[model samples]
Target: MTHVVTESCINCKHTDCVEVCPVDAFHEGPNFLVIDPDVCIDCIACVAECPVAAIYVDSDVPASQRQFLALNAELARDWPVIVRKREPLPDAAHWADVTGKIDHLQHP
Candidate 1:
């Protein structure tokens, strides 16, 4: 099963997970990241790399965040692939522990 990047990642935009992704399945957005289900190999390599614990196996995604499964797939189609790790957004530390920040996700 593919992994899903959840709402906890929306504003934080941490790239640690992207660096561990062997398949380069990660897609970068203006302020978030998504895993392309089509390209993911279920390696689980990126899960632990997420500082916010935002990455989860498709089956392990919590019920409250299940929407991320579809969101990841949808966004991955258009967002550019991100294969290298980069610093998180300047306000990442502030947003990392914030709950329910999905509305803050930037599509551009």
Candidate 2:
């Protein structure tokens, strides 16, 4: 199973996980990051790096956030690959623990 970047990642866009991904499976969006399922190695390296705890194995994604699996897949196809860690959004700390931010996700 692949890891999915869930709603908690929206607007926060922490890239710590990106740096740990062995396959460079992460894709960058305007305010989010998604893992390309086809490229993820199921290594689980990104999960612990996420300060917001937003990365989950596809099988472990909460039912409420299940849609993220498809969302990650769909967006990864178009977003540019992100291989380096970058500063998170300026408001990341403010948004990190906030719940239900799906509508705030920014696509590019």
Q: Give one digit per residue, the lDDT tens place, for model 1 in 27-92.
A: 999999999999999999998899999999999999999999999999999999999989899999
Model 1 RMSD in angstroms: 0.8
**RMSD (Cα, Å) of model 2:** 0.8
lDDT of 1: 0.93
After the best TM-score superposition of candidate 2, give how far the Cα of residue 43 lies from its true spot, in angstroms: 0.4
TM-scores for candidates 1 onward, in order:
0.97, 0.97
- Residue 55, candidate 2: Cα error in Å is 0.2
Checking candidate 1 for backbone clashes, the offending pairs are none
Error of 2 at 4 (Å): 0.3
Clashes of each: 0, 0
